[model samples]
Target: MRSIYLRITQPVIKLMLALTWSLASLQAAQAGETPIPVEKFFKSAQFKDAQLSPNAELIAFLAADNDNRSMLVIMNSKGDATPTVITRYSNLDVIFFHWVNNERLVYGISEKDLGAGEKNSGSGLFAIDKDGKNSRQLIDRFVKAGAPKFRLLPARTRFISTTGNESSDDIYVGQNSTERMNAGINLFRLNTRTGQTEIVAVPPHSIDFLFDPSGQVRIATASKNGITSVHYKENKNTEWVQLYQFDDTVEDGYSPVFIGTSGQFYVTARNGKDTAALYQYDTKSKSLIPNPLLALNGFDFDGDILFDNQQNKLAGIRYETDAHASVWFDEKDKKIQSQIDALLPNMVNLVDKGRSQDANVRLVKSFSDTHPGNYSLFNVDTSKLTQLGVVNPDIDPAKMAYRDSVRYKARDGLEIPAYITLPKGRPAKNLPLIVMVHGGPFLRGGHWNWTPAVQFLASRGYAVIEPDFRGSTGYGKKLHQAGWKQWGLAMQDDLADAREWAIKQGYADPKRVCIAGASYGGYAVLMGLIKEPDLYRCGISWVGVSDINLLYDVSWSDTAGNAWTKYGMPKLIGDQQKDAEQLQRTSPLQQASRLKNPLILAYGGADVRVPLIHGTKFYDAVKAHNSKVEWIVYPEEAHGWGLLKNNVDFWTRVEKFLDENTAVK
Candidate 1:
């Protein structure tokens, strides 16, 4: 709290030291083990995303205001001046803001929700100086009747960037239509000072444009009907020529990574191989430069080049393996990376050179499985990483539990990778286990990160098991494709197998096991209770799908789900027409009667992905079956709660539910 207060500019503003959570003093139930408060795990972060300014002189970050609302706070990178609060929206949180130049910053607003889901609250763009003066609201994304922000965002206008000169009055913008999905975007150069627009170019289709360091639209890509296309131009004045097009049905397709100088196009795609590899497209030959530039073999390289602004060259590639990792291309940057990693050996050191060609000074953020995160300034010439501060000041490394990467073979002899976090200060024994399933079943669900949810459960004497089941990505291509169309059946089995594996290892009490997840993981929880009736004692699902049919049919929902309905649903999920019976049979809402254990259902009132309709209908259906149901509704929230109050409220209730049902009372 003192560190957070020191960073706050105003001293006599009556700082409230009354934190809802604390870590200072604790009773050691076991030697060297302090009981972590549940609120500490579930509460809003003390500070949010941080970034160094263009000159590396100013460090801007989002910090919890005295009111706990998201506020923009700026401090000197060298710690020469006190941190100043720039923009304070008492009603709305500044969800995202960026330093376009040394003088100007553009920020967007949204509800203070968890997971940082991009749900704009019509509270739009704001521009301010480094000193918090001349603050101007650039655009109101969806206008509310309030203090006039800037001009209307022209329906779906998004700020691209201020091209060459950050001090220039003009900024690049993309205008697209919300009326249609996959609608082509019109690129524009708008006067940031006056809100006047100049048309740069109109993309061929709803293809997204890629701007280079000089703010030139170099590459464009779009995918529709399971076929994707890429087009590139030497200059904005040149004719747009088709670079290459690939069948999106072939997995990763020809996805553009980043564009280099002279149209050196880099993309991730599999020509014939399973995993997508990084390749450079040679314009003269009009083909992918024979071999991959950087291929991770088993895993599709899902990262981008670390662009060196000073050198105007590709620095290195930063991609994810288990956690976020980086590989450098530039020797200078690589040398610096090596130095930083050696210094912060425990954490993944992500370094950013602040608009300096010399690379004498840089900002480094060190993070690990155990370490929440700490920021530092790498004085390359001095060869010292000056300690900045931890991302979460509330967390103490001494009290946090260790995360172990574990794997077990499924019934089918397929290797299932997982991370098991045992409770702090306890030996591996028959502990009450929470089988924490992840949200995105198709995504790289369970990575080794400092997750509050996982650590929170582990702090409560629960063995938290996060399994990257058959369909989860990031491991390898084969693991992900195996989950195609598995849904409630094979996917559920993989989770069950993980539980069985844990129980067999004497780490989990089979009688005290509970399944928990969000989104598709939440769907899996229902299926787990349904298919394996004798296994889990309780289950928790929030913002989860209750019906696949609803996912396909909800036109007003998020575009990702709707696109999956068109492209992936037929092949990956199931054919809506032919596989109608299978979809229904697998639907948790359809099979609500199978739920015989304690169940907690949570949903965001405004969740467009899996709307309240799914939760309410499932709740009603389960009520008829006369099963124990705890329904939690967060009205203002979208997919997940963003506000600190809502997060605390929801998690506190969940803690109670688990304690009553799964705790060894």
Candidate 2:
């Protein structure tokens, strides 16, 4: 490979001119608005994940290596050659890569200096050649005991999707099926250059798959006891067929998304409407077509559907409502997304075009709400954009922090959907707030970019918010079935009605608010300090869930024997022997002696999701009569904090526990 790109092309051009002179001297010492540190808002992102190569004339990304690990380079989408690297390791860390055609690429690795409880679950998979030549490994980073599995493909085989046939190196893997409890995912087709294999059609209790722009597979999806289903097949010698099933905690049917090249399928449902749109299904009358083809208003068709397969149609959809848009339906990819949104007129650009039908290169990406994203390239017959880096080249979008997207009313009139943010040259009034919360209290919390723990609590001056409250999930179906079993009652009163609507819109500081989260937002920060103890003046809760009947008595939680805790946690969280006294009146280790303010409680002694016995049994029952609690733990972290020195030692102990409890006095 030209003497290995002439021996690392002068240390990759002196690491891209010392990362462009260290991002121009850290944006000129963050133009005097200093504060931005706590490990540059939790590290890891020196240019990340960019993609583009299925002949969009090369681009690939992930760069860091000067020992910050990641490393996978490659360039030239007209930025005229030179950038090569192609792979690196010295210990491991190319976490996920793609492009299996347009001169090969596939990737996976991981172990970025251990500590997810001493890592190692399977990152393995390799395969190279973009000029680093025929590299290879193809799966085996750990899975040994009795090592002799002949056709070597173990270490839990993954990488699904990328067979849109760029003249085949074939690539649709998946492996999972450990034989019983919810046994699904087993498809394969391999051969990313002769590690050869070809099973390709399991479909029994499958857990999601949907191929078709000629690479085939045609839909799959599964679920179990609480129902779900949706199977289908029309090629590779047919025979799969189940089609429609539903009731997986009802939002009524559909799902799939993408599989057309004339065999059309596309999905996303909630047909009786309350959100979820995008339609077209009809595999000869299995139904679904009742209008729609992309709906959104209150959100829920969530994203992705692009598909262009050398112009076999449907070239855009993208979605994600409180931000992250894209419509296109192909008018030259909607005039190359309005010429890269009239030259990045305030971020959120996107524009992809990977499996290119060539409207001259594309890629883009961009971002906003205090920028933490970049990746460029655009071109489109010489209009140009170029760049291709910066995902946090020392941040500083004028000292980060804007976010916005509001909406309130939750003490019954429903509405909710939050995300505030503040703090960028302050004065959105009172301030000091935190309210953060999101840890999938049923997923989808805040979106509208640049969030490193909400820009590290708005670069330390605080004011954060977040909300999505009532059972979260891309807003719809009456805000996700209105907090199903209402854990800690009406999801802890929609986070104390988002701290009294951020202190009645004076942007917070009703006595300097506070309430943070992790896992189910650390079980709603110990049920929001035991149901709004004078509306939170303190509480943090990392890797939370202090005993909701130990989520069905923790039989080593991966959510105890899955199928989402036997049929989606008794229909969405609750029911441990029929809500035993409403799960001990909302367990925070059973109310930890009605928690008196000032608390911190972090965890992850190798957290198996909210594990170190949910922060050592709620810091041994709120330090027996709370003496201003503060716990911590981290023994090789998990449920969160995957080492950036434990996210700068747990946000520098949340900046001295919000400066000894809500600073502004």
* Candidate 1 ranges with C-alpha deviation above 4 Å: 1-27, 31-34, 89-92, 110-121, 144-152, 162-167, 309-312, 559-562, 663-665
Candidate 1: Cα lDDT at 47 = 68
Give Cα-based local distance difference scores for all models: 0.74, 0.78
The best candidate by TM-score is: 1
Per-residue lDDT tens digits for candidate 2, residues 1-665, read: 00000111111111111112345444543465556678887788888888878767878898887778888998878878788887888888888788878889889878777887887677878888899888877778687778645566888887888777778887888888885467788888888777888897666778888888667887788877768788878887868888788775864777887888667787888778787778778887788777776776667777787777776767667776777767775577788788888787657887886776764878888888778888888788887888878977887676676676777888889998787877665457887898888886887878877878888887777788888888887778888889888888887888888888888888787988888888888888888888778888898878888877787777877777777777888878877787788888888787789889888888888777667877777787789798998888878888888778888888888888888877665
Clashes found in each candidate (C-alpha, N, C closer than 3 A): 7, 2
State every prediction's TM-score relative to the real structure: 0.88, 0.32
Give one digit per residue, the lDDT tens place, for model 1 in 537-565.
89988999998888877766775443456
RMSD of each: 7.9, 23.4
- Model 1 deviation from native, Cα RMSD in Å: 7.9
